[model samples]
Target: MTTHANKKTALVTGANKGIGKAIAAGLARDGFTVFLGARDSEKGHAAAAELKAEGDVRFVLLDVTDSASVQSAREAIESETDRLDVLVNNAGIASAPGSRFKEPAEEIAASMRIVYETNVFAVVAVTNAFMPLLLRSDAGRIVNVTSKRGSIGEEGAWVGRPNMTYSSSKTALNAITAHYARSLSATNIKVNGAAPGHVATDFNGFRGTRTPDKGAEVAIRLAQLGKDGPTGVVFEDDQQLAW
Candidate 1:
């Protein structure tokens, strides 16, 4: 087994709060030098400081929706780290949980646009932008923090919920994972999606049954996959989730 690096670096996007924050803390506890990515510099620094008090952690200003911001983050990371061991796409938006899918065409379209901008487009942009840095590592892993609601099998469950916008965006993200896994099958990179189940997060007004710690479990596990571990798969709580 390869020894863990004393300065292994990982980045978790949208980590100012909720599942993303939990995941970043977990990685740091596991000995990674974490880069806590947040759109808000203030919150990002606060989170990094909280973890830095415990161990090594850095605050990175990253806005997945903005190409320039993503490029700048990539550049900063390149200058600071020799290689990126993990990239967790955990930042997302879920607006209007009670809005019905069939309520209005404009509403549905607007929701889709909002969710897709962060969940789908941002994941692709960050992953593609950081592929080179990941490839430089011996056992690079990419975990797309998705949800079971994204499963096509469960699409019926969200049909009337305008919140389906966030769920469907994740479905597309899973497709991107599969594509990237196939593209890198010959390489050492392992890319997969992790569903945190129904975690109690601000996104849903903290009504979810599971805690952020529980959700972070699968994400941290996926981030630490070995060279031979499975890829192009979706998991929830360490169990295979239906697609």
Candidate 2:
């Protein structure tokens, strides 16, 4: 295993493409030894290779929906470094855009479960597995990539929208972020949620108005926060957002 005693190390899940990829690249460019976590080994390696010019980047296979995979990823990182300075839980899934909401209760429940497996439950599993390593860092940072639609305060805007699974999963993620931030308040760790507004990505059928790089700015900034940075907050661009 190779070690970088002088540089901070970061792990970003779902980093093979889209906003996660942009976050990995941004961290690597900032002199972090970034671990690009992807479920697909081929894509993970490809992304790491693509970012080699930026800094020390490597691929780590991580399937957030699987407990075994999450544990294995934690072990893999532990083998390389004793501490993880940053963790970006960016893996998430959404039901097909513009698809009709299932009329049957069973179908809706299944859809919600599928999305939650990746967005909500996986975040909890992955964070718990890496908590020890994060605590070892001098300035640990956890950034949960969330969405503005998760805001219950904004329900009026999406009252009739067909995004139950995706939006509610984000709401759960925001809550999870708050829970961790408060739990770890006495420590050096900072846990926060980031809303990447309307990014054009495969997840949304490439229909959003912003680019992935622009969407990743807030997450990258939060990841690099100092010891004095705020914890348990949701941020979009540079502004604090409502829970």
Candidate 3:
């Protein structure tokens, strides 16, 4: 095994493609030993191989929705490194047909529950599981991938009244970030939510205006924040977003 005792270590979940892949690439380029986590073994290894030219990148199979998978991922990473400097919770799902208001109540609940399983509860689960490794670092960073539509303070001007699926899941994620930051205030951990606005990805059928790299900019930046950087907040770029 290549020794990474002196390098910064990071993990990006759902990093087989899209913005998560971009963030993993960025971190690798920044000289961090990046673990690209994904549910698909083939794709995860492929992505890690593709990123090898950039820097040190490895694959970690992670299914955020399953506690066993989450535990296994944590163990896998822990075996390689004693500490984790950055963790980007970038796995999420888009809205389904039944997630809308006019849909049947049961359908809406099922859709929202699926979304929440990955978007909200999964975040908490992942963070809590890997938190020990994060705290081992001198400057721990947690970047929760959220959305602008999730902001309750701002009206959804662009995509008015986002359904209970994707948008509401992010709203819950933001609140979790706030509480997490508060809980870890005295520690080295800096927890924050990142809104990768309108990224063109398969998740949205390529309707977005921004590229995956552009959408990943905020999460990448947040992951590398210094000890003095802000926590318990949301940001898109340099601009802080409304909660």
Candidate 4:
């Protein structure tokens, strides 16, 4: 097994494409040995290969919804490093592609399980599985990549197509983030949420005005937060987003 005890390391889930890819690239550039956690082996490898120019980037198979996959990912990561400095739970769906706001009410209801499974449930499983490694770090950081629509406190949240499942899932994720921060308050680990404003990615059918790189800025920033930085808060860029 390889040892990365002297080097900082990070893992970004759903990193084969979109904002997750950008986050992996940014972390790699920032000198962290980045692990691109993706379900698709081919795409994951391809993404890691492309990000090679940035710095040390590798691919790990991670289907967050599956308990076995999560366990395998943890083992794979543990094989390389004794500690995980950063964890970016970026794998999420704002409704399946092309079906956005078009699915029947019953269908949308059925899809809620899948949505929560990915955006909310998976975050808990993956974080818990990796928490041991994170605890070993001198300063571990967790960045939950949520969405602005999750902000029930914002007026815009109700203005959109009213994707109840997706929006509510994010809200649930935000609560989980806060609970994690509260639980780990006395530890060296810092937990926070990042609402990367909508960006032009396949998730939104490319309707966003921002680029993937632009969307990734907040998450990458949160992942590298200083020891004195605030925890249990969600930020979009430098501004805090409502819960």
Candidate 5:
């Protein structure tokens, strides 16, 4: 395969479309060999083909909620490359009917399990599984795609928000980032969380104000962070977010 002295390898989960797809495209353009991970093979292959036409991009089958799928994806990567330079945990789900903040605990708990299964639980699983590959690199990066709604320090509490499932899931993800960063502090890897703000993506019915390209900006920046860059922090646009 084509290679370069400074070439990096990055994996972006849920990249079949929207903000995740944008981040994968941006990273590929930056000279990184990008693996576009998707749950659907058809959509994943199409996305990978589209980006491969522009640069070095490949398809990777990944289902955040499935342990077997995650293991297989990691094995495939190990077979192709010796190191993982970046890992973007962008896979998430928002369960309906009870996904709102005002939903009852019974409904909220159900939605919470689904949301956290993909957003929080999967993040930890993926990170722990790929960490060995990431450690193989000189400078490894991890960017957890979180949300502004997750900031407990500023948002007060998750109870009032109508978007409880999605919001609370992100809050748990932010905690995961901090915990992972602290655990890897002495190493070269830097882990951080990023909120895309209000991005116009299909997940939100494209109602957000910012474009998907704009939403992926900070995530890309955090992924390309140098050895001295900050870790265990939350960011959106260029500003550091609370909690």
Candidate 6:
């Protein structure tokens, strides 16, 4: 029955490892009570324990792909605090490289469904479910972890990039971010998309040049934005990119 009434609170999905865990750790270090949400209880608790020395950190079971799980997590948070200052949608999945382009049509569709289920649909579900709590905060923020490859404005650069499923899902996520930001413009909440660039994680088979800690930087920055910060934009590090 620990209370987080005096501090800002944040929830980072898929926070058991990788970028999600890094973001949770960063938020905790910034004096926010961070809920490390992970589908697996063991991993989630382990991550929370590892970050215990950093600051206030807790573990919450959250499966972004499941509506029931999402609601339960929301209720769990509500039971602890009336407001959610930050919500980081960091849970995502990608088909093995080249699978989208080399697989059969049916296989490609199935893969797309899997990616969209977590990347796009789950983001909408989680954000919508937590909107009430976000609105209650003094400086609410929503950070959708997206990718530069999802930008249609840069389509020419992706000529041979084998990321049809993953890329398109992020594109949809960016759209969701814009839609939410517009819808909540009159309110105090700020919603934006964050591109972490290519980070070395299990999602990309550890081939990326940067580390998960580096990827979490943008999302952490977005999460800590003040009331005056810009909204409805896609940012990479500190630079705003075309949406």
- What is the lDDT for 59 in model 4? 95
- Models sorted by lDDT, best on top: 2, 4, 3, 6, 5, 1
lDDT of 5 by residue, 34-124 (tens): 9999999999999999887657999999998899999999999888888999999988866644344445454545556777788888998
Clashing pairs in 1: none
TM-score preference between candidates 4 and 6, better one: 4
Quickly count the clashes in candidate 2. Answer: 0
User: Model 1: per-residue lDDT, tens digit, 1-243?
Assistant: 122455678999999899999999999899888888999999899988888765677888999999999999998888788789899999888753455444335565766687788989889899999989999988889999988778877442354454456667877988999999899999989999998988898887799999998889999999998777999999987688768
Q: Which stretches of candidate 5 lie over 4 Å from their true place?
A: 1-6, 96-108, 153-161
Q: In model 1, which runs have C-alpha deviations exceeding 4 angstroms?
A: 1-6, 96-106, 154-162
Q: Against the true structure, whose lDDT is highest? A: 2
Question: What's the TM-score of every candidate structure?
Answer: 0.91, 0.94, 0.94, 0.95, 0.93, 0.94
Give candidate 1's whole-model lDDT. 0.85
**CA-lDDT, candidates in order:** 0.85, 0.90, 0.89, 0.89, 0.87, 0.88
76-119: candidate 3 lDDT, tens digit per residue: 99988999999999998876544445433434566777888999
State which candidate, 3 or 5, has the greater TM-score.
3
Note each model's CA RMSD in angstroms. Answer: 3.5, 2.2, 2.1, 1.8, 2.2, 2.2
Off by over 4 Å in 4: 1-3, 96-108
Residue 200 of candidate 5: its Cα lDDT?
A: 88
Q: Model 6: which ten-residue window has the lowest total lDDT? A: 96-105
Q: Cα miss at 228, model 6 (Å)? A: 1.5
How big is the RMSD of model 5?
2.2
TM-score, cand. 6? 0.94
